[model samples]
Each structure stands twice: as structure tokens, then as C-alpha cells.
Target: MLSGVGACPAVSAAEADTTDNAALNDANTTIIVTGLKPDEGQNKISQSGALGAKTLFDTPYSISVIDAEDITRRQANSIGQIFANDPSVFSSAPSGSTNWWGTQIRGLGVRNYYIDDVPLLLYWGGDFPLEPIESVTALKGLTGFMYGFGAPGGVISYRTKRPTAEAMLTTEIGYRTSSVFYARADAGGPLSQDGRLGYRVNIGGEKGNAYNQAGINRLVGSLALEYAISPDLKWYATATYEDSNLQHEPFQFYWANYVGNSLPRPTYDYEKLNVANSYYKARTLAAATGLDWTFARGWSARLTYGYTNKYHRSNKMFVYMRNQAGDYDGYAYNFAELDQNHFGQAMIQGDVMTGPIRHQIVTGASFQQTDSAFGYNDRDYYWGNDFNGNIYQDQPFRVTRAIRFGTGGWPSKEQQRALFLSDTLHLGEHVQAMVGARHTRYRLADLDGNPLVDSGYRTSAVTPTLALIYKPAPYASLYGSYVEAMEPGSRVGGEYANVGEVLKATLSRQYEIGAKYEHRQFSLTLAGFRIERANTIDRLINGARHLTQDGLTLYKGVEAIGSYRFSDRLKLGAGVLHLGPSIRNVSAGNEDLRGNIPAGAAKWQLTGSAEYYVAAIPGLSLHGNLRHSGKAPTSDSNTLYVPAYTTANLGFQFNTLIGGRKVTFTGNVNNLLNAKYWTQTNIGEGINAAMSVRLSL
Candidate 1:
């Protein structure tokens, strides 16, 4: 292990220059391990390398970044709320107050929760508070090569607010028509005379009722600390805690009820669900510690260790009434889960000039282990009769009639180890080339130490990336690249019948190309991509509930993103996506899923926003946002479709002098049209208008 302090003035100067350029310059740059060194400009770290942002703009990939400014302008209540203006992303279901809606990127299942540079795979339900976030970066496509394993659809990374030397405080409170209340506080600055030691903390809480008669209450807290051991060495630690309790009404699919045409309004009984006390409660705790070492010359090293624990319990009752005789039968379910994870990473980075070839290189190793335990206990109940569609039960049903169904109990664990090498080669003054490759090996095992799947299930992969950037001028650049990524499959258990060990997991691959243009006050990016995956996983129509198989799927699309600074007081940003055709292939018995478009892949999506700051009003500003999503099917059955919908949002904020102190007032109206739209049909939830207020000092 490398420890202690090392001296190198050259390394410090070079690192300082890189960090300064990224922080002070507004231009996009690649984000890589070395590119994120402390002291960089205003969180200007790259998503990939030092110039990663520029490269991302030019590459043939659809991506989006929600900056701090965007969050404030939108007055977003939750992360899912921010997605309302994003077309390429959609949610599958609502977690009520406890869970975030599952996200679908590029028509593929993907999770959108991350802290610092680590992925948060376990879903504890509810949305993460935005108080401690600096920015949200979304990469579209198979990004396993950059962010590590899992879905090929893409990845989302949230950079948390770090401790700063400057002290600042902000507090906000808001309310909506749905009887929701929100409050948050953020304070940070140096905790000691020496700025080397600093601290930051953020707290947020919310309570609300929804149009669907559900209710939500949530709390979040985060803390960060940093200590400078010496000029050449530093250490930092961060911790976050979240708790959410939510009651939600189960969605009733109207399209499914009408078969081909749209059905009438649903008679949702919020009272019955409340009586059943259908709700879910979840808690998550995460902590991380990291150390940075600066060496003499042009070299540095960093190590980070992190752990996360998540616990969730949910109770829901589902009823299907037969006839109008006040008769009904349903199942009440209680699910409990515990997920624990540990992650470790170590990296060495340096710059060198070998003859005429100038090179910047980074090599790192990482390991992640996730262990999870899941259990479910369910009971069956019945009502004497059903009065039309009413859910009133006149008599108490039998309790002992509930049999102890077999329990699905197991401790599943997955481990991944990876080594990667990346280099940026300067080809003369105006041109540069980037090439990198990563090798990863992963293993999975059940609690009993038995093999979870076949030999092929334990696998390794080599992913490669290449890109070229030509900067003819100081303020502009043109770039393009080719990249390939892979995704591993899940291991099957021995209890599954009929499925041979040979068919345990799934594998995925993607190919992409694109271009970007950047100028002083405006930036535009357009990219077209084709993605293909083999050994894809799909559920069989009549097979066991969890049964899945290796198949093939293809998705191709084009996306455009642009942002323009009209003036010092006005700015505009917009994005549009068009997917050509998405198809799925399954076995003969799985014909039900063949030839139909995948769920969540809309043909068209559009989003645009405008913001204006009024100097006349002094610290007053106004913002408007619009979003539209095309028709989308609920499943491969293609029998049901969620119609296209559009929504608008407006917000205003200003600061006032009160009693010799500065006070800020803010307000927002979400869903300005109060449009009744189904974000996800399977979940039977609709979007409604809401308003809120905030005051800060």
C-alpha cells in the first residue's frame, strides 16, 4: 500500500493548471480520474476525461446533465420530477413517497441513483433529496465500460456538494395544492481557522398528499468533511441518511379494462387503500472515505472505500372483485429486504512525454461486493360480496385460511474486480487522440457457497474506446469517437426447473458514433447510434414468474441537444429524441413478446426551457419549461398504449431586504395545464398540477 507524503512541485503546477482551466472556463471538458482533481473550476470535472464533456457532446450518444441552476429553476420536489422535462427518460412506476419511479433510458431498464462516482443499485423506494447535489449527469447507452456493470441502457451520476472554504447558508420552504409541504436547509464552510479543514451539511424534509389520494413523508440528511494532512496529502469523508414512509393507491389500468378503446374514469377508493394501510417504509445509510496523495513529478494516487446499507418493508393488498354481490378476493403481501454493499477503488495517474508522443495515463483497480436478503409473507382474504365496484366488506373474512406459502429466502452476493488503462495522446498541437481499454472479471455465489449458475456465468470482458478531437481555434472544437461496452447477466438459482445451467445469464453490446459543435455562447450536439444485444433476458409468458432467457434485441436512434446563452440575462436549452425501430426476439413459446416494440420506447420526445433574469426587479428571475412524450405501450403485448402528453412549468424567485437582512422568496407551478397524464400505465398514476413557496436567508 502507498502511504505518507511525497513532494513534486511539477506535479502540483500541472494539476493546478488542469483544475483551474476546468473550474474557470465555461467550455466542456473530458472528465476522467485525473480530471476531477480538487481545485478544478466550479465542479468542472469530466464525466469521462478532462475534456470528456466536449467529447460527450461530439460523440454519437444521447446524454443530459442537470446542473445546480436547473434544479433551482425548476423547484423540483424529487428527482423523478426533474425527468418530467426529459424525453429520453421515463419512469415505470411510482414509489409513492418511499420509492423513486423506476427509470427507463433509451427504452432499456436503468437505475439513476449515484453518489460521488459510485453507483447506488439498491432501490429503497423514495427520491433522493437534491439539497446536497451539485449536478446530475446522464449518459445514454451501454456505459458499463465507464461506470461499471449492469444495464446497457445507460447511467446517471450525482455529484454531491463538497466542503468548501467559504461559509454559506440557504433555507427554503414550499407548499403545493396537493397538501404537500417541503423544507430544506444547507450550510457549509470551513470549520476551522485553516481552510484545510472544512465541513458541509444539508437537511431536507417533506410531507404531502397526491391526486391519487396517496400520502408521503420523507427526511434526508447529509454531511461532508475534509482534512488537509499536508500540502501533498488530503483526506475526505461523507455520509448520507434517508428515511421515507409512503402510502400509495395501486394503479388500475384503464386501457386493459377497455381492451382496445380508452376506458372511463377510474373510481379510485383512497379510503380502502388507507384502511388496508397499503404502504412501504424504507431507510438507507451510506458512508465513504477517501485519501489523495501527490507525488513528485507528474504523478498522483487516490484511494476510496465506501459502504451502503438499505432496508425496506412494504405491505400491499390487491383485490379483484367478481360480480356486484359484495364479494371480493384478494391477497395481502408483506415484503422485507436488506441490502449491504462495499466498494473499494485505487488509482495511479500521471503524464509523460516519450520522445514526440505526449501522453496522459491513468490506471486503476476497483472491487465491489453486494450482499442482499429478501423475504415475502402473504395472506389471502375475501369479502362476503362486492357492491358493484365498491370495496366495502360487511363481514370479517377467515384468517386461518391463509396457508404458509413457501418462502423465497436467500442471500445473494456479487463481486466484481477490474483493471483499466487509459491514455490521451497529443497528436501535434491542433489534434488529440484518446484510447483506452478495461478488463473486468465478475463472480456470483449464493449463501450456501454453491455455484449460482453455469461456468459461463462467471465471465470477463474487454471494452475499448477511441476518440479524436480537432481544435482549430481556442474557443471551439470538433470531435467524434467510437466505443464499445458490455453488460453481464444475473445468475440463476438451482431451484428453477427446466432451465439448464447453460442458460444462466445475459450479455449486451453497443456501437455508437456522433459529432459536436461548441462556441462562446452556444453549444449543439447531434448523434445517431445503433445498439444490439445478444443473450438478452426476457420473461416467458407462461413460465415461472422469475423465469428469464437469453434472447436478442436492437435499438437505433438519433438525438439532438442544444443550449444558447441569448444574453447576460437570458438562456435557452432544449433536447429532442427520435427512435427508429426497437425490436425484441424470443423463443417459440415466447411469441407473445416478438415483433412488438419494447415498453418505454417512445417514437418521439421533446423538451425545451427558457430562463430570464430581470435586473429591473433586482435579483428577480422567471423560468418556463415544456415537455412532450409520444405514445408508448405498456408491454410487448402491444394491446395497450399510453397516449402522448405535454406539460408546462413556471417559476419565479427574488431576493428582498428585510430588517437589514436578505430574504429570498420563490414560487413554482408544476403541470401548469393540470393535464391528466399517465406517466406509467402499469402503475396507474397521473400527473397533476402543484404549487410551492420557498424563503431563504
Candidate 2:
């Protein structure tokens, strides 16, 4: 019999990083696992929708899984902070700013995210709390065959913490940076004597002055319930809420009407500059329910539904620098934003044999409806203020008006329906092939507050995927895949002439080849990929700037990530990425810009980590991380660039038994050298530190 498919093979237990938090004993333990783990069976599983619960070994995708233990080690609070060491993810904006400043994966903007495989409504980036998540999986490249109607860049999926069979409770207190304090609690266990009902709860809060000397606050709460209806069927439900406030959030710098050839270094202090208004508030609520059933020996079915509601109130100020002298004109914009989504899906998979060949087949259908609303009146407002200030000056923040809740009106609505099917053919003991396609129907509408004047676009597409896998050795797998995706057109920003106009839908394609190897104490993964998509560029038309789809953009890259356990006390991991991005096939008027490097594309990135457990100390470990980012083009024409930089981080953890209870302490310092650097084109950050103490009961 054949087991489930995985991207990579499993490793020995001694090489894996394991903790006894759930089944603790008298023995002291050290846990500092990061990135991909060397675990077996269910612990090594990467949730691949339609492909089943496959491990990393034989799967055809280039994916990375970061567990909760790694997240804690880095003290990541937002999505930007989570992948700080990943070679393939580049932050598009500052980490401490609004959630919209998301990362670019493989030189492409992130357009899709999922919670437990259910798609979310967040079209941009997300800043959801990480305390309640068990793990995060990043699947690189196009995923239209698996997930419909999304960007070609990649997909970010979050796995939530579920109920445990054994009762468990843990609490922790932490502090970060200049003056931030926080506490968190997690509890899970069986709720019924029969062990058929279980529950999990998580809650946390943080508040204090951030590195910028601005007030920052966050609160999160979540609950999960599970019930076993039968030996083969299980039902689960979850609800989560998060609220955050950042006083003086840094607004992203947009180059609309600029005269300078290059961006200048900040003349003011990185942390002390107050560019935006008083504050920005964001609130998120999500709920999901699903069922899993195994009706037969080799077949199973899953049904799921999810809903998400996100709200944001921003009173941000935008300043455009006009010259090299740091002089600028500033404007204030106030708006309330809302995003909502309702998603549902049904999937089934099973195995069968025809003659000498084995086939694992999967089929699924999904539907999602999303609504986005924005308001500028009835409490919200925007202005081309007469205020003018220099970047080196300490200008007073523009006062904000009061906000009347529930006064916003829906402006945009989108609906997507998809049907997909895939088959994995086990040709022999050493070879497998996969083929799949998804048919999607997408509709978009613009409601101008008049029921009679609804305008929109309707389109349909069929995206497909093909892959081949070869296993020459039990511990090694080589594969190649091709995928295509359809993305919805984007609306023009307020700075453009056709501000509210939506362009036609675009298509993207990807070609990838990868290899994975795992043995006793060593593991390695290497991949090469290329993606092509229609470029969206701004052009001067009729004396006005308009954003339109034109020409083509190409992104090609090679990435390698691996880990090795040199000894029982020593381990090392590293990753490297190289990218070649360019533009092509532009109009004659823009011929000079052809073959130029795309903006925000870094040429090279290297990241490495080392961890060691002290033999003399019972349960003490030390870990360090280093990253180097190469120079990146700041403009599409490649006329400007941001210098390369390197950063280092160091941390330590210790565990001990106090009063017959397990207690642990952790501390870390990011940017240990206190080097100031720009995270993006114009976004920069100051050094920070974090420490926490946790107790298990």
C-alpha cells in the first residue's frame, strides 16, 4: 500500500526538535526548532488541499513551513515580523506600520491568504495575531489549480491550534523594545468525560510605547471547539477576534508627482519621525466551521465554510518630497475601510488501482463572495492641505475629525465560483505524475449608492497545472511543474486620473523544477522557477496619468534551503535566493524602459541560523541568525537603487523545574549591532529587543 504524498522524506527522531510541553516529565528539555522540522508521521505533515495531508517529501510544490516554536523564538507579532529571515520574502513596507504594507513573495505581491485552507477576504496583507496559530505554510508560485482567483505570486496559509486530548494550560509574560508589555494564555483539553468533546482557548493583550515613541496596543481572543460524532467523522468550529491601534503609523511613500531622480536618505531620526496623523485603528473578526469524514478505507471527504470581517479607520498624512533638499508638500487623508467575505468549499479524495498503475484522485468545488466599502464623508474626510513642511522639521500632526461608525457604504463587491479536479498517477515505485485544472467564474460590481446604476465586469477562466515526480532513492525526490492562474484587475488609486476605473483581468503562468532530500541528520531542498504576468503600469494619457495593463513582466529565481545536525548539541540551517526580474514588450514610447529591472526586486538574499544546546547546563540553548540582502532597484527604470545591508540577531532560552512545574525563560536582541537600515524603498526600522517568561501547568 502507498502512503500519502509529501514534499520530502522524514528524518530520524534524534535529529528532530521535540518538546515535552504536552507530555512533560521530570527530565529537562530544550526546544528551539525553526523552519522545517525533522519529524515523522503526522508531525511532518504539510496540509496540501486536494492533494491530501501530505508530508514534504513527494509533494511537487516548493513550500516552507514555520511552526509556533520558531515564531516564538523570533517574537513575531505581525505578518511582516514572521518571515524576517526568509530569503524569498521581501517586506514592501515598514513592519510597525499598517497591515497593508505586505511582503512580496518571489518578487510578486501577495494576493491570497487562507486559514486552515479556507480562503480569506483580505485582498492586501494581513496583520492578524499569531498567538492562536499552530503553524504557517508558504506555497510558492501559481496555485490556480488548488486555489482559484488569486495572484500568481503565492499563497500564505495558517493552521490554527486545535483541542488536545490531554488537558493543558500555559501562561506567559513578555516585554519588547523601548517600553512594551504583554501577557498571553493558552488552554486546551477534553470537555466531556467520554473524550468526544474538546475545546481550546487563547487570549492575549499588549500595550506600550513603541520604538517610534508612539503608543501601540493590541488585543486578541479566540475559541475552538471539536466533537467526534463517530469513529470516522469529526466536526470542529472556531472564532477569533483581534483589535489593534498604532498612534502615528508611518504612511507608505508613493511616488506619484516626484521630480527627483533618486530617493534620499532620511535626514531625521528613524524612530522619532512622526509622519502620519494621531492614530490608526484596525479590527478583525473571523469564524469557521468544518467537518471531516472517512467513509471508506482509502477515501475521505471534507466540507468547510468560513466568514471574515475586517474594519479599518485611518487618519494618515502623505508627504511627497519635491527636491534633494528634503523639502516636501504634505496632505491629509481620512477614510474608514471595510472588507468582508463568505467562503465555502467541499473536497473529496481517494485511491484506486487500474491494472498495474495506482491512482489517487481528488475533486473539489469552492465559492467566495467578498464586499469592500470605503467612506470619505459622514465622519471621514480627505484634503490637499495647504500645509508645507521640510522632512527635517518637526511638523505638528494634522488634527483628525470624529468618526461616526456604521455610516460607510459598500463600493465594491466580488464573487468567485470554482470547480476543480486532479489525479496523481503512481506510474511505478519510483515515478508519479499529476494533472489538474480549475474552472472559475468571477464577477465584480461597483455600487455608486444608486440601486439602478450598478456597473461591473464578468469573466471566466480555466487554469491548469501539470507535474512529474521521480524518486531515484527512498530519501530523495525530483520534480517539475507548470501552473497558470487568473487574477482580477486592480482599481486605480486616488492619485491616478482614472482613480476608480478597473482594468481587464490578467493571466499569469509559472514553470518550476525542484528537488528534495532527507536523511538521518541532514535535509536539503532546491528549486528554480520562472513566472510571467501582464504588467500594470502608469502612463500619461490626455495629460492625465492612468494605470493600465500593458507589456509583460518576468521573474525568475533559484532558491536553496537546508539544515544539518552536526551533533546532538549542534544544528545549522541556511537559505539563499537569487532573482532576475525584468520588463519586456512595452510600447514604442516606453522602449527605453524595456529590459530594465523591476522595482523592489532584490538580486540576492542569504540567511543562516545556528543553534547549540549546552552540555554543561541541563536545559539551556543558544541561537543566532544572520541575513544579507543585496541592492535592489528602487524604480522600474533601474535608474535608482537601495544599498545592500546585513543584520544579525542573537537569542537564548533556558528551562527549569520550579515547585514541580516547568518554567522557561527566553531573551533576544534583533539588530544586535544597532545598525540602522531601510527595510523597503523608504521604510526603515530601529533596533529592538524582547524577553518572556512562561510557566506550564
Any idea what lDDT model 2 has? Answer: 0.74
> Tens digits of per-residue lDDT for model 2 on 166-204?
888889999987788999998988999999999989999
Tell me the TM-score of each prediction against the true structure. Answer: 0.81, 0.93
Superposed Cα deviation of residue 656, candidate 1 (Å)? 2.7
RMSD of each: 8.4, 3.6
| Number of clashes found in candidate 2 | 11
lDDT of each: 0.58, 0.74
In model 1, what lDDT does residue 76 have? 65
Candidate 1 backbone overlaps, count: 29
Q: What TM-score number comes out for model 2?
A: 0.93
For 419-476, candidate 1 gives per-residue lDDT tens digits of 8887878777777788877777877655433454533347777777677767675333
Q: Using lDDT as the measure, which candidate wins?
A: 2
